[model samples]
Target: MLMERYMRVSQAYDKQVYTEDGIYLGKVEEALIQDNSRIYGWQVRLENPKIKEALRGKGIIVPHTLVRAIGDIMIIARVSIKKEE
Candidate 1:
């Protein structure tokens, strides 16, 4: 479902997050907000097995600008996979 309006941050907790291409990234662990009271991003816990290994102990931070939609799940614009050197 398309979100009609802004939602409370509390409503977003535990929601599964995915890339536009359908790769499961993780769940919404926390929301990042600006001092002006605007949400700027989210702190997503790594859940995908492959990403978990690459991320090590680091958490994923998705920028709000990349967010495509919000509903039962949050669909984000596809993120480029960065290969480790």
Candidate 2:
């Protein structure tokens, strides 16, 4: 489940990001916030072997909608994140 209240954007930095399936993707590099001050997405540095191999060093952008929960770590929908070329 999602958090019950708001969170400071700075708190997300360095938080480990992982897939719901438990694949360690990377750490939080930045958070994309809209002009309205809402978190729109997350910019995660590539770290996982498989995901990095396919993504080719490019950072991962996970939309807020794909985020299942937020707290100690970030969990995203892996299937959709692996948008292979």
After superposition on all CA atoms, what RMSD does each candidate show versus the true structure?
Answer: 3.7, 3.3
Clashes per prediction?
Answer: 0, 0
Which candidate has the highest lDDT of all? 2
Go through the candidates in order and give each one's C-alpha lDDT.
0.80, 0.82
lDDT of 1 by residue, 33-70 (tens): 99968898888877898887876744678888888989
List where candidate 2 sits over 4 angstroms from the true fold. Answer: 1-4, 82-85
Candidate 2: clashing residue pairs, number: 0
Candidate 2 has its poorest 10 consecutive residues by lDDT at 76-85
Error of 1 at 29 (Å): 0.6
C-alpha positional error of residue 70 in candidate 2 after TM-score superposition, expressed in Å? 1.0
